[model samples]
Target: MARKKRIKIYSSNGKKALLLSPEEITIVKNDPSYEKNYEIEFNKGKQAFEVRNYYAIGFWKDLLFVLIGAFLSTIAIDYFISITGNAGLFPGGLGAIARFLSIIGANNITISASTLYFIVYFIMNIPLVIFGFIKIGWKFSTLTLIYSIISIFFDLILQNIPYINPNEFSLLIDYNLISSLPGAWGAIIWIFAFAIFGGMINGFSYSITYKGNASTGGSDWVTYYYSKKLNKDIGSLNIKINIFILFIVICLNTIILKTQHIDQTIKLSAIYNEYNSWNELINSDLGKALDPILSAEDKVSIDLFNSWKNLQTGNWNNEDWFNISKYISSSSEYDSYYTSTLVWKMKFKWIIGPSLFASLTLIITQGLTVNRLYPKNKILNLFISTNKINEVQQYLFSVGYTNNIFIWRTVASKKNAWNDQEQDLIMISMPLLYFNKIEDYLIKIDEDMIINIIGSKAVKGKNFSYTFDNELREKALTEEFMNNGKLMKKIESNTIIKTHKKMKKNGVSIQNEV
Candidate 1:
């Protein structure tokens, strides 16, 4: 018998591998099969060593895309708030930032809620972009900063534009026209038209910014960093972060209400309304029947009823009611008769609207990215029978698992036969989104095929991550061009030239392939 001899080989990392015999080493040096294995190993190493360029495209085009996305997001925010009455519908962290700013200057300056919201939003983004710089990259951080600044100006411009002012636009619609509709129709319209549409618009803006390797700042930065770090779904992480922020905002709002004496004003308004109701009751037939039995000179009831009736009829609308001497001397009466009568009603729709909007927006956007957000690649491994392997592999490739496949033949002991059976075990790494389709395909090929699904927190090789389908993008562009042919025609030349130059210069690779 010939003695077995081993030839040691060293990996690029300097780790020695006892892999081949003397004859195997000779084959490895000259055989095509060995060359193919070497190429695969070399490519795997290259993937680890190659520096990933975050800004794969030029800064100018990316800046334009980020700006457009930011502008659309601002529009969505304004429209959502205007239509929903601010009941807490501002998306993401803007509401909490706005409320915090308001609390900072509750006494000194009187700023419009809309103006304050945008101001706080822009200011808070300054620190947030720093995190983007550290976690993401320079290009991403710079684009986010630009987006924040441009969006602030864009929001201000839209607020001044009377024709597109969300408040004015919503008011122009006649709710009375839809009054004959079902009671729930109003709610349905508000949710579907304002909430759902606004959420989708915001999601589109986010997706666009993400495609350009940028973010819109605020909770976006938080979500991005933590999602990468924790290897969790971006949407799930966003919900947790926003919920915590929302809780803080609610606490701060309660404190503001207490400190500003707004709660007292609300109580006073309720009391004033009650006084008017009593006055009307006294004037009714029931009161007339009871008046005879009541004690004479009931000053408390008389004063309240008389004061309320006088205010209702405008008998106390004179300057004498504003006189300092009367105010000081009859302060208690003055407060009940005039102070409480003054309207100091607070609209909570602003608070509630933004909260709802932020929550819903996170849910929609996260749902869209969940399947692709994992850091590690999920794979479906199969110990498929050799006879059905080709059919199974082709079916999977057609569905979207185009690469990352391996196969090997092995002998298996037969239960009651003299000969052993040959079986082929196939392995494939695929995106979780295609799991169901692959499973269904496999069932058609062999119902008893051995299968195992394994999830990883990190994947190192070529990744075919889920991305937006080109068919959808093409359809959207076609519809837009058809709807506004003249507008598209005017910009078509410039758009094509710019796009071609950018793609060429940056060596931009398209992710989605037919």
Candidate 2:
């Protein structure tokens, strides 16, 4: 056999090299002279590929975007907590991690729970940033760190806003609406509004951060890392992670309740042991009836009988009665307080808060992740007749729908020979946001035009605005604009009023037009 030929391949670190036999190498290296040249070219190509695929939208710009995202996310979290009165209702990925840390920190620290909670939240994210640095790119990790820090700073600032105390900031609208509404109607409205708006805001913030190719650190880093490693979609990964966190939260709350119950039981037992029996128990009608039946020869029964007799005969000291009354009153007060506290805590913390948070988070992450993976703008396919195609196409292009409009030649069949005309078939794929406008424009051109609108999941092409942009993304999904007909009516009314005033000033009779 010929001398076994060997080729060198660089590892990802570019420091270590691997030797492969010619037979083992997938590509054939035919020219001996160009073997070294081939390796050099391959290395250069690898470097170029790496550089091209990396995501970075300038250092400062990315930082700014991440900061803004963090700020908005913080506001959303605060709003959620205010409305629900349950910090556990925070829907962001970092929320579960933060709440876990807060609970642990609150147990150990003497400081304000809220203050310690944020501090721990900030500290816990450091490891996540490090992990991102190693697994993801350094730029992404740096941006995440910046976002976390900025978020922590903002959280602190929000807590101390001169006239506005975040802790005291309640959702007055929600409260008022809930209070005013009868039965479950108020609660239903409050919950629907809270979950929907909160999810939207949180999703919007996450999308904004993602657009900068970074995360606010926490599950975001984990989701991105696994998404890349496993060759999976980030949105799917996020849903799985959040579901796991929600489960953990439920388990934790259960453990907490059990532990609290055990502790309360132990305290009650200690109180029972300390007081033994109160005068009320000894002086009861049953105690009096039972004392006479016991034999005096029995020391145990005699001691109990004497104790009961002493208590009923007013032979007990003032100090003993004082201690007995104090203990009984304190125990009653404790039981009453604990019952109320437990009810509120369980209602808000264990049930309503987490359920709302999880539902909102799931909705947001699922929707947003799908949008991110499919960045193309949603389109509506419009098929129109040729007679009005020119007018419609011109109007669409004029209004910035020039990206994708497919035209075709076809015969337009008329029902009667009297109205026969050559009709041009035009198919236009317009962005969903402009669908209403396009429909109105088409109707204006030809009121009886044969128009069909088909909704498309996405439209892929250059020069088209992707749903990644926050404002456009929100407007498209929320349908924030008024209906075209209503808008046109308003405009027409205003124009008529202005025209009528102008005509009156000019001394012209335009009353009929007005």
Q: What TM-score fits each model?
A: 0.44, 0.44
Ten-residue segment with the worst summed lDDT in candidate 1? 320-329
> Model 1's lDDT to the true fold?
0.51
In order, what is each prediction's RMSD in angstroms?
Answer: 18.6, 23.1
lDDT of 1 by residue, 1-514 (tens): 9767754443333432334465644533453343454444444433322223223425666777788888877777666543443223434465455645644553457744555566777787778877777766566688888887887788788778977676466532432233223332454354445555566667677666765557777787877666555544466556676666765665455444421222222333333333234355356443343344332336335544444345445465333222222222222322323332232222242233333444455445533543344222354444455557777765555444545578888776768989997777887665454464346657778765777666645545434443223244334434534465543332332232233334435664321111
lDDT of 2 at 141: 86
Q: After superposition, how far is residue 319 of candidate 2 from its true place, in Å?
A: 45
User: Tens-digit lDDT track for model 2 on 1-514?
Assistant: 7777765544434454445464533322232323554445444543343344334325666667787788877776656543443223444356665665566666677644445555666788878877887877676887778777787677778778865645566543544334333343354445556666666666677767866657766677777676555433466667667666765664564444421222222333333333334364446443343344432436334444555445557676444434333333223324432334343444334343434444555456536653754342456777877577777765655444545567777766668677656777777765554464346656788776787879887645445542223233324322322233543333333333334344446674423320
